[model samples]
Target chain A: MIKAEGLTKRFDDNLAVDGLTLNVERGEVFAFLGPNGAGKTTTVRLLAALIAPTDGRAWVNGYQIGEDNINVRRSVGILTEAPGLYERLDAVQNLTLFAKLCEVDDVAGQVEKYLRLLGLWERRAEPVGGFSKGMKQKLAIARALLHEPPLLFLDEPTAALDPEAARTVRDFIGEIKEAGRTIFLCTHNLDEADRLADRIGVIKQKLIQVDSPANLRHSLYGRRVVIHLASVTEPVRTAVSSLPFVEEMQQMDNALVISLDNPEEQNPILVERIVAAGGAIQFVNELRHSLEDIYFALIEEEDRETQA
Target chain B: MNGAKIGAIVEKEIADARKNRMIILSMALIPTLLVAMVLGTTFVMLNVESVDEASLDEDELSMIPAELSGLNPSHALLILLNDQFMFYFLLIPMMLPVYIAAYSIIGEKETKSLEPLLATPVSTSELLVAKSLAATIPAVVLTWLSFIVLIIGGYLIMPEPVFLAMIRPVWIVSMVLLSPLLALLSVFSGVIISSRMNDPRAAQQVTGIFVVPIIALSLVVLAGKIFLSVWMVFLAATIALAVDCVVLYFAVKLFQRETILTRWT
Candidate 1:
């Protein structure tokens, strides 16, 4: 639902987002992972048509950014990093105000729907100033969904919240994804992105990589399997290392950290060799890589390349 | 600019202002106290005039122009005093909006609420107009309400002609026509200054510059440098309306969406 070609935004001398070409499919949870001042928020603002791009072009929900700002805004919902609610206004009053702005047909019914869905119905009459961070964030989420815009742009929706509040926001994001809406999530929380995103675009004012989490991990580290052996011996090491399928092997006491591209297809044959080599296999499982590891590795690699 | 969207903003501001202490203090408390003090002090001046008639200069009474020769001597003096006091009433509309407009825009900046609002389909003109209208309403309402109390108080205490002077064409035009225009003037200027600045107090202080010229004008009128006639009232209203247009243009130009999103803190 979002497409950008060489999208660049420059503020005087500093380039915020540079040459970011990307496409987000319908009903996909696309997480924009970047550090502070790395153009995540700037990218969100560009796509939402809240700010105009310095160069290049983008289409959000099929509406061009600068050419069709009003239509572009109408086609998408945005949850800004800050809650930015009118503190003195009650929850119902706040929702009603935005509902009218969005020209929602059943304003009262829709406001009630989101409020109840977010579990905030009981306190709908109270001033939002009295709400907790989680409650206020939920109210913000409700505001974004008030008009049911197909594309939702969420910029750091859970930033600075406590663990529980952040979890609530993540859970809400999960629910939004289940409803088949396209979400463009901008965040620095790798864990949140890893758990929630169908595809993640790691960025540093430029599109470094964009792919599904699984594909990124496989490309970066290949496939590694941990084989728990009763004991490690010279014959076992020679047997495992001599195999054509094994890329690398590390001896860690009784566990062999074996690196191979196709561990699933090659594992049974390797086990037969290990058995013939007189090694007892205990358990075997594929090693896992967290998004943080991939994120930092990619960032460091980019920095070294830039320096080079 | 959609009228319904503008109405929604105005409606929201009214509901929010009802609970806002700054709005309440500026719109309600200040005007209430000013009305009471103005009427109370006018009664005192009138009482002391009756008791100390000899000390009062009867010779100055001749200065009442030949046009007003038909009026009673004391009532003519009451008319001039009422006219001078009426100039201060303009302050009611002028001063109240200074606070409201200052708080309206800068409060949005400090709270970081403008982005989401801008993300909606509403245009810049619509948002600014809505805020201007919302701030102007209370100022105009309180000005009229205070003017009513001033008129009724004059009616009860003074002679019929002196009370009639309170509703003179110039005063009515100034109150009914010029006061709202004056309030719009304050609101638009306030919106400009408030949107650009981060501190509400700083915004209010800067917008407070609007009151200086009004006060100076009051002093000029009080000193009898120029007699205000119906034509002058209309002329002043015309000028104010024109200036409102100019300020509104600058306000819209200064309120750049990109500048606000990127540059404004």
Candidate 2:
């Protein structure tokens, strides 16, 4: 779990994170989304106690970030943007060293456990310098999880990996979440966030919006339902648009996309009218707003507010 | 301050150094080569032309230190040259540590390995102390090893009494006391400089320049301007220990976790 109140970090004249307050509950996957230079990495560093917040306070895993930093560091795992591994050291040696530093009991067993879990056990003896970027990143994740900390702070967890490797990392994150560990993942990948995050926080030097993926999309653009018909007949269009619950409707190809004032209360009446009007309905489904749309809209709104 | 964490870091460095060809070569070969070159070249110079005991002039006799004045010209020259070479031994403690400690921290940064290590439960003091110990221990060991080799080699070529006298209280005190203190100073200075600079080469170059005065002191001893006796060795060790304390204090002060993670690179 993570809690921050008015957490601000300033480097001389530049404000990296400004008066940002947030809470991530236990066993929740909270994805932090922002563009470059948007204070995402800085916020992660502050929460991890790698750097102290200039003003305000934060608690990670129930320990105050600045005051109980040692305990806080011990309780959380961090995967930096760069894997930051000892390239000259092999995977097993790397994990073993971290395990000892963390004072993990049975360090060898812990190292082997994480290395095998991350699929680096086969290459344990090979120097990490020879590993592919994806392999190195996976090894880094393994290093973070070696001590099995309750909380994880991942910065750009899949930044430079190929699509397949990225998917593997995403699946691993999902697995971590399913295991009931708190994750504060900062990433530029909105689609991955959409799929894996229980809640996503869109940030720009401050917290812009924080909500579940479905709730954010619904708040940005009200529920949209699409009726796929055999043909875009005038009868279907007029019948659907004339309904009391229909706020707006647009015809795209043979589908009629309608935004309703309240789809839950009014969808049955709309569907009955389409059937009674002799319109051949192929399928009907509610259209959900993509995370990409909400991401751009939120970021653009923040930029516009800044300019004003 | 946890010893286990510090031990883990030092152990990791040793493992890394074993795998690093440059570090292994510098640690093992440089000291060997330096001792061989200094002693071999000295042996050839002293044994080039043996001189009669009575033929030496008083001016040349007076040039030798008072401790070795009673010996024959050849014996006296061997002792004087051996003593002059003691300064070169100082170079081992002073120079080798600069290279090791300079590379240790900045090399980690360049490789992008410092962030995660710092992110661990190890405190800054623990990290810096482990690093200093890692650089200092091997350098001190090599210094002692080279001194042993030099002593054995000197005994083989030079007169036994003269060689025996050279390894007296002064040399023993210098090797045991002054050498480690000087190595500590070099390592701590290197850690400080390496932490502030982004490039390892630049850090090493600067540390090399800062250690020039210690090297210059060795040159002064070689020139017979500064006579190094057991008492003088103790004095030098005392002064170096004081300086080491000061350098360590400032190193700890300058070594900020936030600045290192954000400002350097």
Instruction: Please report, in order, the local distance difference test score of every candidate based on alpha carbons.
Output: 0.86, 0.85
Model 2: residues with Cα > 4 Å off, grouped in runs? B52-59
Comparing to the true complex, what docking class would candidate 2 get?
high
The top-ranked prediction according to lDDT is 1
* Runs off by more than 4 Å, candidate 1: B49-73
Q: What is candidate 1's lDDT per residue for A1-308, written digit by digit as tens? A: 99999999999999999999999999999999977888999999999888889999999988999999989888899999998899999999999989989889999999999999999999999999999989999999999899999999998889889999999889989989999999999988989999999999999989899999989999999989999999988899999999998999998889999998887789998899999999999998888899999999899998898899
What TM-score does prediction 2 earn? 0.96
Q: How far is candidate 2 from the true structure (C-alpha RMSD, Å)?
A: 1.8
Give lDDT tens digits, candidate 2, residues A1-308. 78899999999999999999999999999999988998999998898889999999998889999999999999999999999888788998899889988779989898888888888889999999999988999999999998899999999999999998998888899899999999999988888898889999999999999999999988999899999988888887788878867889999998889998678888888889998888888998999888999999999999999999
lDDT of 2 by residue, B106-219 (tens): 888788788898889989989889998888888899899888888888778756766776788888988899889988888888878887787766776777765677667766
Give per-residue lDDT, candidate 2, residue A261: 65
Clash number for each model: 0, 0
